[model samples]
Target: MELLVKSIALKSPLYTSVHLIIILASAILGFLAYKRNPNNPNNRSFLMLNLSLAVFVAVTYLSNLDLLSISTQIFINRLTFSIGFILVIVFFNFCLIFPEKETKKSFVYQLLIIACLGLAAFAAFFDWMAVEKVVSGLVTFRPRYPGIFRLFFYVYALFAFWGIGILYQKIRKLKGKERTRVQYVFLATLLYIIYIFSTNLIPAYFGRRFFIGHTALGAIVFVGLISYAVIKHRLMDIKLVLLRSLAYLTMLGSLAGAFIFFVYYLKVYYQQFVDPDIVFVLASFIAAFGFQPLRRLAEKTTDNLFFRSNYDFNEALSKLSAVLNHGVVVSKLTDDLLGELKAILKAQNGLFILSKDENKFLYCLAKNSKSVTIEELEREEDIIKLREAGLEVVVNIPDDDKCYGVLALGPKQSGESYSTRDLRLLEIIAPQITMAIKTAKSQEELIEKVIEERQRINQDAHDRIYNRLGAMAKLSEAAAAQSKDKELFEQLDSGLRQTVVDLQKIVNKDTATIKTNGKLASSLKKICQQHQKDYNQAVKYSFKASNMLNLDDMAWDIECILQECLNNAGKHSGAKKIRVNLAQNNGNLVLEVADNGKGIHNLDISNLPQEHLGINGIIDRVAKFQGIVDINSNNDGTKILVSIPLG
Candidate 1:
């Protein structure tokens, strides 16, 4: 009789304990899902299902506790089963909408729910299914006509298997860690189904409960597995939820424990010891004073254990701001920014685009596998389409008229879409990036402008010096020719002739000219011979002329252009030889200057400064004459080809 009593006490705790654990775990999971995404109707429904399950389990456990009479037990059991049946039906629907799988078997799912409701109703109203009784001073339930309840169990088993199979198929198609989570859920559910079948069928077959503890153990294992998946895989940010819950729990636990201890000690001091309540009051005062500090300590410990890596959102934003201020290279800065964003938001992909032109955008940086090109996305139409489709394409263009660029970030990780907060973050960072690009462009333009101004000044100086020297020579000739006395005539003639010769030398500086009424070829030959001697380097000058071209502003410009070319070759190129050729090609004046010297390689004309005298002046003069200047150079030699359109 004692052994029987002990066995009953042990058996009574089993159902109550198992059900309580399930209720607690389910409540925790449901609360977390709801907290993370309050807008999701599926999450709300799942929370409802979990709450209903908890209530059903609690009532069943109370009935098992024998806190109520036999009739009450029967009523409670019926209610519990009804609630469980409803919860199971809701869970089936929740799975359907939550995972968002294809509903090929919708009719079958609805029919199963209907059948479960019918069975639950039958069991609740009639004794044909399950009967309640008092045996050995304990309330126990036994199936009167096992066939009806067995059918319900069989249907439950089938649905459970179907759910597991569906999840398995889905898992197979999924990639990465998400797949592993789904697979774990599948295994846990499979275990749960097996345990359910064994608890019902095995007990009924053997005429006694066999391995009843296994069902409780299985429930604990399944919930534990699910909790592991939620926290480890971050299925829904369950760690944060759990940490928050634990925070509240710690505070409540500490306060409740303190209050109870205070009241009990007060009672013991006053009633049992027959002492004044003063000592008890003093003790209570001390305990109450310690509550806040204790609460703080508990909070600190819990935070360290669970919320260790959790960073304040505002603090992270400040850190990001600091990073941006450092003026890092755009690519490296972008990579770091994206990495931080991915970690903070738990996103999958991030891309950044900067405006390249008024109508074009260049993808300056990308963090994830998002492919876009500057050439392809040149229109506003594509941008609008992307935004409409819910991509976070943050246009960095300011409200002011000067705005030009757009920044695009997109396709967050985990297939979960971006939120309003995400849009705001992108908006904030977009301006910073735009400002950086603008600063860089402005600096570049300033440098270019400085270059242009310097080049103009150098060319003006060269022109003024040449004009002044020519005027001085004309004045000296006029003064020398005006003298008339005999001694004065001889001296004046000699001096005048010398002055004229000096003036002629200035005009024919490059070569000696032959005086003739009309001899163009002879003049050309003389000019070519003069070029060979004037240039210290070995120069082969070849001249080919179609007609005697009339000298005009065009002729002076062409001569100046050739002089600039020769000056550059002599000063810059360490050449041993040169080739000067003048000809008429395609009704155009063509002058070719070639040198055997180290050539200009990879010359970036765009970045050339205004103070660059040699090349800049040559280019400016050629441009003024509407002429073409082609410069080709290699390690072997430099070649300057000048072509001016002539009639």
Candidate 2:
């Protein structure tokens, strides 16, 4: 009696547990597939495929839950089987769209998939494919009622093979990471298909009751391979996912092993006093409610024992990330990073060096070290030699087009090579370091540009406005000397008023007519029309609805720039017709102003003097927004193009 009870409890739940695990794993992968990138077509297709597989596993799991009523079990079985059956078509549909490839399958394939779905629906409604009666209030599969079970499986096989073949063809045409991703799916599909054939179909064909029916256990490998491809190749974050999976499995397996031992000892010690049935019930009760608390305890204990240092590493990086996100200045960022690296690597000294030109380390922040020289570390070979001499060195650029930096950590206090665990911690935070450096450089450049622009604006005021004021003083002295002459005095007064008006125009070129409702196009059009209507110049402009702009001061800068160009066209270029074009191109707002008039020669904007307020003002305004300006002038006309990032 004890042996029989043990065999039933262990063997039955074990197979159910395997299916449940696969179901949980597949569901997790499906959730991650969408969460990683909801907009990616490949992610969507992968999610659908995982959903189908999860449903299939869940249907298998439901077959072993003995607590449900017979009617409910029968209903659930039918519903889940129908879903699983339909998902076969879903899987094939996924294959047609996998890896972001949109290859349309043939007409025959579409018809076959629809026919398979219809047949599955028919089987689910009628008692043809699977029919069973309630026995002892428990539903169980009996014999088929003259249904096309073999035909259904055959159709499923046909679609699955066709999909796999399509995937293989797609794989053959791809290269690099794309080919690698498809290879993972193709291998998993091939392995699962072989397992199904060898374990379920071949044995049933030979008239055998095989235990290999639950070989869906191989789904663990399938989901694992797909997850690895996503994490290692696609760069989806699998850190928490992997940790939780490991922790949960470790806890569950440990508790299960403990329970098996508990059951064996209880049977030995209590079977004579209590009924074996009572002992089994007690064990089941313990397994039900005790698993969750036990898992939490085990997870805590495991973290303390094995992952304590990793916890510290992650915590440190998180704090450092917070500092980077805040408005930490570049000079302070280097110092903070140096301190963190020293603490994390447990090294006696650390160095943070940046190279604007990538030719030499011009900026250095070293903590507790003077042995290193910038000249020695400038060469790649020298850095390699240092890395060979038990020092860990990492070199990276903040962005692809900019300066690069290097981090070198001296030997640890314990004088041992850095562990793989330590290296992994460093690798995980390397990109964050690069991003922080990028932020620092951006902040520095903005400040520098602001200073340069201020100097240029001051110089413009000195040359154009202040110098005119000095001449006005001299003219006033001459007018005072000729006070008796009424005509000269009247002319001087009129000239002074006109000079005041011109100075007001230069200072107030950036009008406060900008909209707060993000209607940049309307404002631009208003400016264009005002110029045409007020000055009677033919000004034409074009814009699209998708070119909507809403940047604080950015749109204003662009407005001022366009206005300046139009003013130059109307007042100086002697142009009659001006064409203005505005559009959004690849995350940038682009504006082009073209005029049909006598063109100005030597139109290099960089060569424009401070006194040339028209072109100088345009350059200064664009520089403040990190914008680009190009001027082309010839005998035809002058065309000015300006581009500013929409952000």
Candidate 3:
């Protein structure tokens, strides 16, 4: 009863008010991020970090208040101490899995968390510092604790440094703007941790605990950087980050109004302060001249943060222009355009559907669908499928030259409605997009025609020359059988036959020569049979690939390699039997050919023996696809291995 009377007589300190504001602000920022995406582990851990900070500040401040009784004050102190360590541990956990990277907790990390939890629990139950009926009130000097409490300084330092190292590793792994934005977050977190350590732990060790109210202010840097990252770079989510700042502002406005209501309107503490009439005149003057511009500036600042830095129209235009200027492939250009636009607008998805089926294709960044046809993309919300696919704004890719298909963009990532500005930006870039599609298609068609024409001319020459060569070879063979000098005629026939084989290989240079619907197995088997008949030796062809190679040039290149290998082995290896195997291994198409004969004693793939000229051709062909060639040969036998990447 005496204690309650004494507490009532003691005036309420202003530090408690400042502490409450800080704690509230920190909590609001945390919950905002968590609520935006609770499923995201980054968001989940960030919430814990913020809540721990709030609790740390709250208890630390409340423990220093004179109104609390000795027992209550001591309990708050223990909790504050526990929360202090918990904050650092939580921060360390955050560092492990931030910016959307999944981390498997190592045994050492798990042990650290367990150790921190144990220490926190011990601190809560049993005082690390020697204390008896005392509270570290702001003005009242706290009693000197024992040396054991000082050891925790090392613990805090260890966790802080550990977090820095983990954060550094994670940041190093990132590239481009992502690394820069995360560095902001890293710097922010580092400052917060270091600030708390400098202000709280060091001061407490010296038995002069100051800056209890400032603990809340320390995390403001972190909160600001987090908001900056989100707003400027759209870090976690734009809506989540900006709303917190806006909410803080709204909260401050309400607090100011309430404070004015009590102190001025209700006159509770108004009597002792400056005169009301003079204050009212000054308040009116400030509101008239200052409030409108201040409000406008705040509004303008947020708009600039979202649009000017993040979703820049000029930058998007420049990017689209660069893509249009440099791109020769329609497929690649479409992909780059969609990706750039989606990122710039902070959009959920984007799509480009080319019309007429004349080098026409459909591309999208949407998850619901990977495909969309010209029929399905009619300006595009009119199409039920497109609306269902989450396309919110669809722009017609039409101009005087051609009526290209629609370019549709989904809703903003923040779930905000698209403005006229967004639609206009897309509108302006639509022509460049259309031209890019048209120009790429024209170039592709021209190149295809050129390839077709070249193949036609080559076929004409090959047919006439090959027939003449065949006739000459048959005549030579007849002369070899009839004439007295048979060896010379037989040698001429063999050379003619080799020339025919080389000519046939020249025709097989392009995939257009083989109309096997991109099937390697059937074509390879057929070619192997023909080669077996020519060489008059047992030849085996095995095809065992699961994933299809999508690269257009891969099939022809592989065939060329196989032909070169077979020809080299047949002519040079003097092999009786040849075994060819093709299979998929580790995302690569593995092709191996083995000849059971006297080996060529080849040492290097690039620098083969003088006689292995065809092997050099095989290596050159394989180099186009960025594939690997390994020739393992000795006195027993020779084996040629080719591994090409499969899409």
Candidate 4:
């Protein structure tokens, strides 16, 4: 108990320096982790671990200074031990959430937390029940430690190993830079825990009386490694280490400079009459008094120098507007805007994702993301991976009442902080980008609607037109039956058949622009099927395409010629059967038609286009294609041949 009031000069120089350094480093890491994303549980737990260590170190340092009475020391020691228990739980919590947030509301997570809180509650009372004694000028261990002490140690070790196992699995599951980050954090934790065993628990196990109450100070290793990971691998992100550390370090340097300047000025004025203690006090006073204001100035100055100096808001807006106005080409606009933003912000890596639903996402682009996942937007043990791969800011692209998606920005190439100004620029751009996404989504919906409407219209036209035509054909047959005139029946049948064929051509051509698999043969096959269905008579046609016809419009012209020839054959050649031969040979297409029917009298092959309407149509079509025609007539059948040059 008397050691509590022992001389302050007995404080070890090494212990003082180590504790101070740990506090500073821990404060920096913890603060940055919290500042970057306050809503993140992973970061919150990280912050809690660091804060507990810093407070414990601070209290231990003050305990050595005789700044508290014996009772106060007892209470503070127990409270610090409680914090230590909490620290262990926080570290485990951090491990469970690495890369992203884990579901802490689960039964296992909640049970562990409750167990730690229970240990923490008992740690404050049972920890200092031993008779007052000291080891290494501090109460680090008792000769025979109480049950609560062993309990705290066991819980700490259990959680540490469990946390390490969690990190190990994550490192194995992840790849590339993500794997590297988890490995760094894992190595850092394993080292720190090993450090704790060596410096705090190992000595006690061997019954060493003089203990080193430096476990809190030894956390420098953990903090140092984590800081390295943040800067190099973007564990929580690079800006977490870069922005605040630089600004505060500048402030610290300014304070140090003022202290030195004051010290020298006081020494000069009071050379002979100098009291060293008074001089020290006065300089420290000036530096301490100037601390807050100097810190503010230094932070602002550092921000301007490192990031704000080169940033021009107007230029950024102009470039963003240029990208947005590039056009509604969805893919082009998305890729172009991502490139533009990445360049403008100078980000080291980036992810741009727009999800429409659980299964369907709008678009995804990476500015060298190292292969981040869709689930990794808020990276986790199993949630995502990019949170460790330099992700810094996630801005929601919002329009009206809906949020289309987020634009996740990675750490800057310059490792500068993503300031509010940069965020404001993103905010302005998000709405316009949302408009582009909406346009693309609307286009897809419009295409679906057009297809459905076209199908409906085609079905209606087919039903109504086919019904009316069928009724007309029935009436024509009925009239022919009553009049008993064979010539009139033939004329009516011919006119009706020709009208139906022309109408079918117009309606089918307009309603369905079928490509038929990029081949003319497929279209001709469809025409043959329709001819049989329309006239109820078969036209045996054989087609052998020797080469790919380079002509595109030739498909339609050839189809028309076949339709006219078939019509003429079916109408006048009533002797039962007709056959068509279409063959391509040596850059020329030859078509032959023959039917067993009554022959035409004095048919002119060269000037047949001037004869019957159907025959004239066929002759005209053949002549325009630069082809020759030959016709032969006999009592049994008639044969017509046509040839057209391809080149």
Candidate 5:
């Protein structure tokens, strides 16, 4: 018994024990992660590595127990090393699944696999590559053909470094939680490589077993750190497997300990040893039987801890669709979306940008947990990508297959990541959002069309009715001029003159267009020449356009408004001198009409009869095109300043 204990101690059974513990722990984590997210290639790869490591550790432990012959032990040791090499190769293949580097570089991947296979072959077949035997009661590998194994080690090191380099590069480019998770993976890989290289080198250099226990210790620490990272930060959403594995491990350990105790206690009475195999079989059965129930419990616990409710991202999108269908204003729609997103996503901040086109985005809505600048959120490339991807909802917008824009919500509370289910929900709701936006846009366009049509009809009616009345007034004046009786002639002339003035006022009120030549300055010159010939007042008109003013509807409207003001000054002001000027200043059309006339300081313009419509008509017409109208009177003259915007 003393010799057996001495052999176990000398062979470092504790090292094998710790190695088994680390392997088992890693296996549980990998298994749980795989069970929860089987499709995640990373999880699957890690699980494969864990299973391979567990097998290697178990065989190593059996070899240390000296339960098999020396030749058998040597074969198991080579087998263990071969398995480890294969697992490392598979780890690289897993990395290739979502490689940080361009995955299209197929040659690189093929070369990597070929190199791995070559190393595996050399390790398995070449006796000189790896020769294992008991050295000082501890099983160890000695390289007889150091050159080949050294070459293999260097290649393996290069591969490990390459993976670490890729992970580091990816982490540097990633932001927030992704960066942290990637960093954790890189660090874990770095520690693993360090342990392997350092342990292997220490034996080679000193010809001693200085690293036997240390390598296992390092592995234990590395795996523990990685498992913590997996759970705490939800790196790759691996927590489900990590948690379930831990639960099962705890249950199995407790059952195994109880069975061992029961066996020991029953030994004296039965005079027979209870088989450990039976306990293992029973424990495995219990664990298997409990899996479903435990999984359900885990799911419920996970729901309570991480995903409190069924976050119906689709439901929020449906509400947005209803608002849009109702033809709600864009501002109101933005507000509603922001509010709902904040609640549904449990976001720290929310931003919704509606794309006007591929390049132009409108900052339509935002809500923030803290005081955040709109500019900062607007500038993020992730937001831009979201819009570009057209992932606003699940259903595609009917008119266009492309997305209008994205409704980006969160940075969720605690910087949690959006799960696959969350992304799917967004996809499902996107179509309804697109339809709502289309409906709203169509309604707005229709409203604008109606407004434009009504304005056209009003202008047409005003021109037609007043122009005919002006002709009738002129005919009455002619008839009055031809009357023979003096009293009758005087009566007819007075009535006709009054009628003509009334018709002129009507024409002026409705028809504001001033017929000027194409060259406005030349037209004003002609108007001055005509006024000088007809009136006692010396009329002077000066017109200028800073540049060639191409007149549109608004420009025309301003010209008409000015013309009405000038006509009123000519017919009503009765000034001795009249001046009209037109010029362009500061991208605005400025027209001034001034007349030298009785100031009429006491004129109660507001109290004017309903028949007098000039002032109100000018104001209303100017207001339609968002122009400004200013009227001022002094002792010597009346001046009107009309300014209209250029569209």
Candidate 6:
């Protein structure tokens, strides 16, 4: 115990430095692994492996320091051995599952791993593995002479070899990015194996420590290689990790070194002149004042050194904000925003998706990559490969309540992850994009409404009013020939012919403005009868005119809705019997149409596809009156109910 304290007081500089490096490297790697993907088994295994390595190195360092009592040292030694065994097990597990998971494993293989772990646990506590002793005011642990120690070494080696076999097998099966990941693991494992053999196996067998106890520091090299692999190969956006680490460590190291220099100078040159307490206070004040500034400077330097593309992120956002402040043309918005985001983010590919309907994307534009259609991307499971390829997924583009679109920016050109700043800027600008899209959609719908109104008037004039007028003219001419008083008949015929002309003129004028007060009920009845005659279907319809007021206001909407429903029933529903009911109730005009045919399934009326023109027209016409629609459908039949308030 006394010797242990002496060794700590006279701690080796090399030993202390090596211990710090090992500890820092292990912590950083483990943190990164867990942070990247906490739930992923592969990442978890990697974290565990790193933590075990840390424990192994830490205990070894503590035992060497000899600051603790003999019992404490022995306990630490046991922990070290136990962690070492656990490390190999974790590594083997990582090899089997990382990069890409292996789904199948034999029961025997699992039992073998368990058996190896049990043996390791036994070896960790058994004094036969290594026994502690003190000599020359220093504590040292001696392993069992070669022949016996070889058994434990061989077991660990066998497990390592199993991991190597798994890695080799995986390398053969994997391709592209996954293969690269496995290759990294293989290289890291190779270095670790070499380090263990040279530093540990050789020394224990030969009964001599190499490199004057500096050999243990070789573990840092192994940790570093693995860390490099994780940073460079597997995870794409480690720029944050690298930059933050560099900034903080550089700032800390500089401050610490400067303080040490100042203390040394003060002690050696001005011990008599300077008051030590005052100097300490001054140093504290300087450090406190300098901390933030130093950190900022270091952070800037790190960004400039490692992330040059980020320098213009703010500038890019400002430019985008300016562009999006104008008219909302969806196509223009998608095209422009996607291009800007691609440039700003330095991404290889991008997708701008806007809601075409309630359930699907209406439009998709791809920049700097092949265009993947919405149908192609609807399956979530299939896009995993694409995600790995740098798909920066952004969904519900505007806000949570309203998802106007989705934006997927591909991997950055420099293979960096999307920074928080970049995402924040995007979130900030999402509303502007959404407003623009809505405006564009509104403009489109208005134009379509105008065109449709004109077509309906022209078609209705030719099909209904014009034909009726022509038939009435012929009937009046025949009646004039049959009249006994030729003069009265001539006048009557002239008036009747003039009435037909007036009606034709009225039909050509704005159809909605044409009064439909007395005509709405009769018009609905005629439509139902005509549908029955046209399609040879049993169409039972009834219209109750009581309390139905101000019919002219809703006349156009009702006419269109009824026509569309009848047409759909005839053409699509394939029904033998159709029922139409029209009544005024609760200050609202109510219309219900039911059909005994195949029901509408998987239908979204808000975003109906192009082929359902009848249904689309019905919805559009009803919407003009701020009507409510309810559709009940099943395998047996379909029923539609529409209600438009009288107000």
Model 2: worst 10 consecutive residues (lDDT sum): 367-376
Query: Worst 10-residue stretch by lDDT in candidate 4?
Result: 359-368
Candidate 2 stretches with Cα past 4 Å from truth are 1-13, 64-84, 105-109, 129-147, 205-215, 235-647
Per-residue lDDT of candidate 6, residues 342-430 (tens digit): 77778788776664453242223222122232112433343455565456535346544555576667777875555434555676677
Question: TM per model?
Answer: 0.49, 0.41, 0.43, 0.44, 0.43, 0.61
Residues 1-647, candidate 1, lDDT per residue (tens digit)?
55434533665475556777898988888877776556555457657756765665565554454434566556666665566566566656655554442345467667877888887686567754244455665666666666665675666656566666667777878888668777776776677667756774457544553222233345666677777776556454355446546666777687778777766766776666645466657667877787777666665665555432344657767766766665446666667766777677665555554445422422232222133321123234453455454453334534244444554555445543333234446556656765665665566678777785564444543532332233334444554675443443443344445436434544443222323333433444443443343334565667788766554445444544555555456556777777788787897778888988888787655466766655676776777667787888889978988887765
Best by TM-score: 6
Please give me the total number of clashing residue pairs in predicted model 3.
Answer: 0
RMSD of 1: 14.9
Clash number for each model: 2, 0, 0, 4, 10, 2
Cα lDDT, model 4, residue 463: 32
* Model 5 agreement with the true structure over 1-647: per-residue lDDT tens digits: 65545545565656757876887777776676566546555657767766765665565454454534456556655554565577667656545543232245478778878877877776666565243556545555566665665666666666667776777778777887767877777777688778867875435544443233243456676677677677667754555434445555555565566556655555545435556566556656765676666545544454445543555545766765565566445656656756765667665554445654523433232112111211123233433454454322221222354445556554557544443344445555556666666666677788888885565444433433343234335444654786554654454455446446534534454333433334555544554553343233567677677565545334335544544554456556778887777788787777777889865465454465655456555666777867787777878888877776766
* Candidate 6, pairs of clashing residues: 237-417, 356-362
TM-score of 3: 0.43
lDDT of each candidate versus the true structure: 0.58, 0.64, 0.66, 0.66, 0.56, 0.66
Q: Is candidate 1 or candidate 2 better by TM-score?
A: 1
Worst 10 residues of 5 by lDDT: 366-375
Decreasing TM-score order of the candidates: 6, 1, 4, 3, 5, 2
Better of 2 and 6 by lDDT: 6
Please list the residue runs of candidate 4 whose C-alpha ends up more than 4 Å from where it truly belongs after superposition: 1-14, 63-76, 104-109, 127-148, 210-212, 238-245, 248-647
Which has the better TM-score: candidate 3, or candidate 6? 6
Against the hidden true structure, what lDDT does model 5 obtain?
Answer: 0.56
Better of 1 and 2 by lDDT: 2
Positional deviation of residue 383's Cα in model 2 after best superposition, in angstroms? 34
Candidate 3 lDDT tens digits, 198-276: 8777787776654443565677677778766665555554342444367448545844574466446634455567677
Instruction: Note each model's CA RMSD in angstroms.
Output: 14.9, 19.1, 18.5, 17.6, 15.1, 11.1
